[model samples]
Target: MKRGDIIELIEDTTFYKKGKKAYFIGRSNFNPNKIEIVWVGEEQAYKDGDIDEFPARLFKQVEHGDR
Candidate 1:
């Protein structure tokens, strides 16, 4: 997802970063091609496997007018 895309951390329910919980506001992407979402908080999960896959319905596309 691109910048400003609202995303929820479905996996790692116990994990949290930047004092936030559940939902996170997407700020950017580490790799646009890979569709990795980058938020304001630091990476909490150490391994890739630690992250659980979010269901299709959980992911909602937000309108980002311009870069």
Candidate 2:
């Protein structure tokens, strides 16, 4: 979906494990089919600028107020 949407991993993919939640940043610059996301975590290991790109098919949009 569009940028700023929240998404959750539905399948265990190489980049992320199942159930991981992330913020949808945008599409990959190199590939339109790929999506960029910033995963949510309690640890500070994930820097503010850290972003990951994964296949769009692996994630599903999470609605607001969703658990």
Candidate 3:
């Protein structure tokens, strides 16, 4: 997905539950191979700087009809 797109976590349980939504913030500075994202919605206790990075494979572009 492109930057600023609404992406969903497909298989991440460490920071967010599967199917959770986030804003794509592009590649990580620490590791270009990973994509950074800003968390959206509840469950903030696990958040770090409101930003986190993970592999693109763990996320999917949210479709218009998908919730």
Best by TM-score: 2
Error in Å for residue 1 of model 2: 1.8
Q: Can you write out model 2's per-residue Cα lDDT over 1-67, one digit (the tens) per residue?
A: 7766788999997656899998787899999899988787622534646678898998898855333
Query: Model 3, 15-44: lDDT tens per residue?
Result: 578999877877888887799877666336
Clashes of 1: 0
Model 3 stretches astray by more than 4 angstroms:
42-49, 63-67
Per-residue lDDT, model 2, residue 47, is 60
Q: Candidate 1 on 1-67: residue-level lDDT in tens?
A: 4544455543443444332222223332443223334333434652332333333333445444245
Candidate 1 runs further than 4 Å off: 2-5, 8-42, 46-49, 63-67
Candidate 3's TM-score reads: 0.68
Error of 2 at 48 (Å): 4.0
State which candidate has the highest lDDT: 2
Please provide TM-scores, in order, for all candidate models, with all chains considered together.
0.27, 0.75, 0.68
On TM-score, who's better, 1 or 2? Answer: 2
- Which model, 1 or 3, shows the larger lDDT? 3
* TM-score pick, better of 1 and 3: 3
Clashing pairs in 3: none
- Backbone clashes for every candidate come to 0, 0, 0
